[model samples]
Target: MPIISLPVIWIILIDIIAWTFFHLLISVICLKLSSTFFLRESYWFKIFWWEKSGKLWQKLFRVKRWKGLILDGTIFLKKGYDKKGLHGTKISDLKTFAAETKRAELTHWLSILPAPLFFLWNPLWAGWAMILYALLFNLPIIVVQRYNRGRITTITSPNK
Candidate 1:
Protein backbone atom coordinates (compact mmCIF):
# COMPACT_ATOMS: atom_id res chain seq x y z
CA MET A 1 0.00 0.00 0.00
CA PRO A 2 1.13 3.53 -0.68
CA ILE A 3 2.29 5.47 2.34
CA ILE A 4 0.40 8.41 0.90
CA SER A 5 -2.51 8.55 -1.48
CA LEU A 6 -3.37 10.74 -4.47
CA PRO A 7 -6.28 10.58 -6.87
CA VAL A 8 -5.85 8.81 -10.19
CA ILE A 9 -5.28 11.99 -12.19
CA TRP A 10 -2.75 13.29 -9.71
CA ILE A 11 -0.93 9.98 -9.80
CA ILE A 12 -0.83 10.01 -13.59
CA LEU A 13 0.44 13.56 -13.69
CA ILE A 14 3.09 12.86 -11.15
CA ASP A 15 4.19 9.78 -13.05
CA ILE A 16 4.60 11.74 -16.26
CA ILE A 17 6.43 14.61 -14.61
CA ALA A 18 8.59 12.36 -12.53
CA TRP A 19 9.61 10.12 -15.41
CA THR A 20 10.41 13.04 -17.70
CA PHE A 21 12.35 14.79 -14.99
CA PHE A 22 14.48 11.79 -14.16
CA HIS A 23 15.10 10.85 -17.77
CA LEU A 24 16.28 14.29 -18.79
CA LEU A 25 18.26 14.76 -15.63
CA ILE A 26 20.16 11.56 -16.12
CA SER A 27 20.71 12.18 -19.81
CA VAL A 28 22.07 15.67 -19.28
CA ILE A 29 24.37 14.57 -16.50
CA CYS A 30 25.73 11.71 -18.55
CA LEU A 31 26.20 13.97 -21.55
CA LYS A 32 28.25 16.51 -19.61
CA LEU A 33 30.73 13.95 -18.34
CA SER A 34 33.76 13.39 -20.54
CA SER A 35 33.36 10.68 -23.12
CA THR A 36 36.68 9.33 -21.87
CA PHE A 37 34.96 8.58 -18.60
CA PHE A 38 33.16 5.84 -20.43
CA LEU A 39 35.87 5.10 -22.98
CA ARG A 40 37.21 2.07 -21.11
CA GLU A 41 34.85 -0.86 -20.94
CA SER A 42 33.78 -1.03 -17.35
CA TYR A 43 32.86 -4.36 -15.78
CA TRP A 44 29.19 -3.66 -16.21
CA PHE A 45 29.60 -2.97 -19.93
CA LYS A 46 31.86 -5.91 -20.74
CA ILE A 47 30.78 -9.07 -22.45
CA PHE A 48 30.35 -11.66 -19.75
CA TRP A 49 31.23 -15.30 -20.24
CA TRP A 50 27.56 -15.81 -20.96
CA GLU A 51 27.39 -12.99 -23.51
CA LYS A 52 29.74 -14.47 -26.11
CA SER A 53 30.69 -11.04 -27.31
CA GLY A 54 27.02 -10.12 -27.57
CA LYS A 55 26.13 -13.01 -29.82
CA LEU A 56 24.03 -14.41 -27.00
CA TRP A 57 21.56 -11.58 -27.38
CA GLN A 58 21.37 -12.21 -31.08
CA LYS A 59 20.62 -15.85 -30.49
CA LEU A 60 18.16 -15.43 -27.64
CA PHE A 61 16.50 -12.15 -28.53
CA ARG A 62 17.02 -11.86 -32.27
CA VAL A 63 18.64 -8.52 -31.64
CA LYS A 64 19.83 -8.05 -35.18
CA ARG A 65 16.26 -8.13 -36.50
CA TRP A 66 14.84 -5.53 -34.14
CA LYS A 67 17.91 -3.41 -33.42
CA GLY A 68 17.03 -1.14 -36.32
CA LEU A 69 13.71 -0.37 -34.69
CA ILE A 70 15.37 1.37 -31.77
CA LEU A 71 15.14 5.11 -32.14
CA ASP A 72 18.25 7.07 -31.31
CA GLY A 73 17.51 9.53 -28.52
CA THR A 74 20.39 11.86 -29.37
CA ILE A 75 18.20 13.73 -31.82
CA PHE A 76 16.42 15.18 -28.83
CA LEU A 77 19.65 16.48 -27.33
CA LYS A 78 21.19 19.57 -28.89
CA LYS A 79 24.78 18.50 -28.18
CA GLY A 80 24.73 14.86 -27.29
CA TYR A 81 26.69 12.41 -29.44
CA ASP A 82 24.58 10.80 -32.12
CA LYS A 83 24.99 7.01 -32.01
CA LYS A 84 22.42 6.10 -34.61
CA GLY A 85 25.05 5.30 -37.23
CA LEU A 86 28.78 5.29 -37.27
CA HIS A 87 30.18 8.55 -38.66
CA GLY A 88 33.44 7.04 -39.86
CA THR A 89 35.67 3.96 -39.87
CA LYS A 90 38.75 5.59 -38.38
CA ILE A 91 40.14 4.10 -35.20
CA SER A 92 39.43 7.36 -33.39
CA ASP A 93 35.82 7.39 -34.52
CA LEU A 94 35.40 3.74 -33.55
CA LYS A 95 36.82 4.40 -30.12
CA THR A 96 34.42 7.31 -29.61
CA PHE A 97 31.52 5.25 -30.84
CA ALA A 98 32.39 2.48 -28.44
CA ALA A 99 32.60 4.94 -25.60
CA GLU A 100 29.26 6.39 -26.60
CA THR A 101 27.62 3.00 -26.47
CA LYS A 102 28.83 2.68 -22.92
CA ARG A 103 27.54 6.15 -22.18
CA ALA A 104 24.14 5.39 -23.65
CA GLU A 105 23.91 2.10 -21.80
CA LEU A 106 24.84 3.75 -18.53
CA THR A 107 22.26 6.46 -19.03
CA HIS A 108 19.47 3.94 -19.47
CA TRP A 109 20.64 1.92 -16.50
CA LEU A 110 20.62 5.04 -14.35
CA SER A 111 17.23 5.99 -15.67
CA ILE A 112 15.68 2.88 -14.12
CA LEU A 113 16.91 3.65 -10.63
CA PRO A 114 14.07 6.03 -9.83
CA ALA A 115 11.27 3.59 -10.52
CA PRO A 116 10.81 2.53 -6.92
CA LEU A 117 10.29 6.13 -5.84
CA PHE A 118 6.88 5.99 -7.47
CA PHE A 119 5.72 3.63 -4.76
CA LEU A 120 5.68 6.48 -2.26
CA TRP A 121 2.47 7.91 -3.69
CA ASN A 122 1.11 5.36 -6.10
CA PRO A 123 -0.84 2.26 -5.23
CA LEU A 124 0.90 -1.07 -5.26
CA TRP A 125 -0.07 -1.98 -8.82
CA ALA A 126 0.89 1.36 -10.31
CA GLY A 127 4.21 1.34 -8.55
CA TRP A 128 4.96 -2.04 -10.04
CA ALA A 129 3.89 -0.63 -13.37
CA MET A 130 6.47 2.09 -13.01
CA ILE A 131 9.21 -0.49 -12.53
CA LEU A 132 7.89 -2.36 -15.53
CA TYR A 133 7.80 0.85 -17.50
CA ALA A 134 11.40 1.54 -16.65
CA LEU A 135 12.52 -1.86 -17.81
CA LEU A 136 10.41 -1.80 -20.94
CA PHE A 137 11.58 1.68 -21.80
CA ASN A 138 15.25 1.09 -21.22
CA LEU A 139 16.11 -2.54 -21.91
CA PRO A 140 16.02 -2.36 -25.69
CA ILE A 141 18.42 0.52 -25.76
CA ILE A 142 20.62 -1.18 -23.21
CA VAL A 143 20.82 -4.38 -25.20
CA VAL A 144 21.61 -2.58 -28.41
CA GLN A 145 24.38 -0.67 -26.70
CA ARG A 146 25.96 -3.80 -25.32
CA TYR A 147 25.73 -5.60 -28.62
CA ASN A 148 27.13 -2.73 -30.62
CA ARG A 149 29.86 -1.93 -28.15
CA GLY A 150 31.19 -5.44 -28.31
CA ARG A 151 31.31 -5.37 -32.10
CA ILE A 152 32.85 -1.91 -32.24
CA THR A 153 35.44 -2.55 -29.59
CA THR A 154 36.36 -5.90 -31.09
CA ILE A 155 37.31 -4.13 -34.29
CA THR A 156 39.15 -1.43 -32.43
CA SER A 157 41.09 -3.79 -30.24
CA PRO A 158 44.57 -4.51 -31.58
CA ASN A 159 44.51 -7.91 -29.92
CA LYS A 160 41.34 -8.95 -31.70
Candidate 2:
Protein backbone atom coordinates (compact mmCIF):
# COMPACT_ATOMS: atom_id res chain seq x y z
CA MET A 1 0.00 0.00 0.00
CA PRO A 2 1.13 3.53 -0.67
CA ILE A 3 2.29 5.49 2.34
CA ILE A 4 0.28 8.47 1.25
CA SER A 5 -2.70 8.19 -1.08
CA LEU A 6 -4.15 11.19 -2.87
CA PRO A 7 -6.72 11.76 -0.16
CA VAL A 8 -4.14 11.33 2.55
CA ILE A 9 -1.89 13.82 0.80
CA TRP A 10 -4.68 16.36 0.66
CA ILE A 11 -5.42 15.79 4.31
CA ILE A 12 -1.80 16.28 5.18
CA LEU A 13 -1.70 19.48 3.20
CA ILE A 14 -4.80 20.74 4.96
CA ASP A 15 -3.31 19.83 8.28
CA ILE A 16 -0.20 21.82 7.46
CA ILE A 17 -2.33 24.81 6.47
CA ALA A 18 -4.32 24.55 9.66
CA TRP A 19 -1.19 24.39 11.74
CA THR A 20 0.19 27.44 9.99
CA PHE A 21 -3.00 29.37 10.65
CA PHE A 22 -3.05 28.32 14.26
CA HIS A 23 0.54 29.35 14.67
CA LEU A 24 -0.19 32.77 13.24
CA LEU A 25 -3.16 33.30 15.53
CA ILE A 26 -1.26 32.32 18.63
CA SER A 27 1.71 34.44 17.65
CA VAL A 28 -0.43 37.53 17.18
CA ILE A 29 -2.21 37.00 20.46
CA CYS A 30 1.05 36.53 22.28
CA LEU A 31 2.55 39.55 20.59
CA LYS A 32 -0.36 41.68 21.73
CA LEU A 33 -0.35 40.29 25.22
CA SER A 34 3.38 40.61 25.63
CA SER A 35 3.04 44.35 25.47
CA THR A 36 0.55 44.30 28.32
CA PHE A 37 2.07 41.64 30.53
CA PHE A 38 5.76 41.66 29.68
CA LEU A 39 6.35 45.33 29.08
CA ARG A 40 9.79 45.29 30.62
CA GLU A 41 12.95 43.32 30.18
CA SER A 42 12.53 39.75 31.37
CA TYR A 43 14.42 36.49 31.41
CA TRP A 44 12.53 35.37 28.32
CA PHE A 45 13.85 38.32 26.36
CA LYS A 46 17.47 37.81 27.29
CA ILE A 47 19.79 37.68 24.27
CA PHE A 48 23.00 36.71 25.98
CA TRP A 49 22.22 33.01 26.00
CA TRP A 50 20.80 32.91 22.49
CA GLU A 51 23.27 35.24 20.91
CA LYS A 52 25.19 32.39 19.28
CA SER A 53 22.13 30.92 17.61
CA GLY A 54 20.93 34.36 16.65
CA LYS A 55 24.24 35.14 15.05
CA LEU A 56 24.20 31.84 13.19
CA TRP A 57 20.81 32.63 11.79
CA GLN A 58 21.91 36.15 10.94
CA LYS A 59 24.87 34.86 9.03
CA LEU A 60 22.83 32.16 7.37
CA PHE A 61 20.25 34.64 6.14
CA ARG A 62 22.38 37.79 5.95
CA VAL A 63 19.77 39.46 8.12
CA LYS A 64 22.00 42.50 8.72
CA ARG A 65 21.36 43.80 5.21
CA TRP A 66 17.57 43.43 5.38
CA LYS A 67 17.02 43.78 9.13
CA GLY A 68 13.39 42.73 9.34
CA LEU A 69 12.28 44.78 6.36
CA ILE A 70 9.53 42.29 5.60
CA LEU A 71 8.25 42.24 9.18
CA ASP A 72 8.31 46.05 9.37
CA GLY A 73 5.87 46.11 6.50
CA THR A 74 3.34 44.33 8.68
CA ILE A 75 1.03 46.16 11.04
CA PHE A 76 2.47 44.41 14.05
CA LEU A 77 5.53 46.60 14.09
CA LYS A 78 3.97 49.61 12.44
CA LYS A 79 4.36 53.02 14.00
CA GLY A 80 1.82 53.91 16.69
CA TYR A 81 0.58 50.34 16.75
CA ASP A 82 1.68 50.06 20.34
CA LYS A 83 0.26 53.47 21.25
CA LYS A 84 3.61 54.69 22.56
CA GLY A 85 3.50 57.63 20.16
CA LEU A 86 5.31 57.80 16.83
CA HIS A 87 5.03 54.00 16.75
CA GLY A 88 7.74 53.44 19.31
CA THR A 89 10.34 55.61 17.61
CA LYS A 90 11.59 57.09 20.87
CA ILE A 91 14.69 55.37 22.24
CA SER A 92 13.08 54.06 25.43
CA ASP A 93 9.86 52.97 23.76
CA LEU A 94 11.74 51.37 20.93
CA LYS A 95 13.83 49.37 23.35
CA THR A 96 10.79 48.04 25.16
CA PHE A 97 8.99 47.31 21.92
CA ALA A 98 12.02 45.56 20.53
CA ALA A 99 12.19 43.30 23.57
CA GLU A 100 8.54 42.37 23.29
CA THR A 101 8.83 41.96 19.55
CA LYS A 102 11.76 39.62 19.98
CA ARG A 103 9.78 37.54 22.44
CA ALA A 104 6.87 37.38 20.02
CA GLU A 105 9.13 36.26 17.21
CA LEU A 106 10.53 33.49 19.37
CA THR A 107 7.06 32.44 20.44
CA HIS A 108 5.93 32.30 16.84
CA TRP A 109 8.76 30.00 15.86
CA LEU A 110 8.45 27.78 18.93
CA SER A 111 4.71 27.34 18.52
CA ILE A 112 5.27 25.58 15.22
CA LEU A 113 7.09 22.70 16.86
CA PRO A 114 3.86 20.93 17.67
CA ALA A 115 2.87 20.87 14.03
CA PRO A 116 4.65 17.60 13.47
CA LEU A 117 2.66 16.03 16.27
CA PHE A 118 -0.45 16.39 14.15
CA PHE A 119 1.25 14.32 11.50
CA LEU A 120 1.87 11.38 13.78
CA TRP A 121 -0.89 9.45 12.05
CA ASN A 122 0.96 9.77 8.80
CA PRO A 123 4.22 8.10 7.84
CA LEU A 124 7.46 9.15 9.50
CA TRP A 125 8.48 11.03 6.42
CA ALA A 126 5.36 13.14 6.58
CA GLY A 127 6.03 14.13 10.16
CA TRP A 128 9.64 14.92 9.41
CA ALA A 129 8.66 16.97 6.44
CA MET A 130 6.25 18.97 8.53
CA ILE A 131 9.01 19.70 11.04
CA LEU A 132 11.36 20.75 8.28
CA TYR A 133 8.72 23.00 6.75
CA ALA A 134 8.06 24.64 10.08
CA LEU A 135 11.74 25.38 10.61
CA LEU A 136 12.22 26.69 7.10
CA PHE A 137 9.23 29.00 7.33
CA ASN A 138 10.05 30.51 10.73
CA LEU A 139 13.84 30.51 10.76
CA PRO A 140 14.17 33.66 8.70
CA ILE A 141 11.64 35.51 10.82
CA ILE A 142 13.53 34.55 13.95
CA VAL A 143 16.79 35.67 12.42
CA VAL A 144 15.40 39.00 11.36
CA GLN A 145 13.92 39.67 14.76
CA ARG A 146 17.14 38.80 16.51
CA TYR A 147 19.21 40.94 14.19
CA ASN A 148 16.86 43.90 14.53
CA ARG A 149 16.73 43.54 18.30
CA GLY A 150 20.50 43.54 18.52
CA ARG A 151 20.69 46.78 16.59
CA ILE A 152 17.93 48.32 18.64
CA THR A 153 19.66 47.34 21.86
CA THR A 154 22.87 48.95 20.71
CA ILE A 155 21.07 52.15 19.82
CA THR A 156 19.22 52.27 23.11
CA SER A 157 22.21 51.53 25.24
CA PRO A 158 23.24 54.55 27.26
CA ASN A 159 26.90 54.15 26.37
CA LYS A 160 26.07 54.09 22.70
The top-ranked prediction according to lDDT is: 1
lDDT of 2 by residue, 53-73 (tens): 357556676776765245442
TM-scores, one per candidate: 0.95, 0.69
lDDT by residue for model 1 over 46-115, one digit each (tens)?
7676777778778888899999988777777777878878989999998888888888999999999999
Clashes of 1: 0
Among all windows of ten consecutive residues in candidate 1, which has the lowest summed lDDT? Answer: 40-49
lDDT, candidate 2, equals 0.61
Residue 56 alpha-carbon offset, candidate 1, angstroms: 1.1
Candidate 2, pairs of clashing residues: 79-87, 80-87
Q: How far in Å is the alpha carbon of 77 misplaced in model 1? A: 1.9
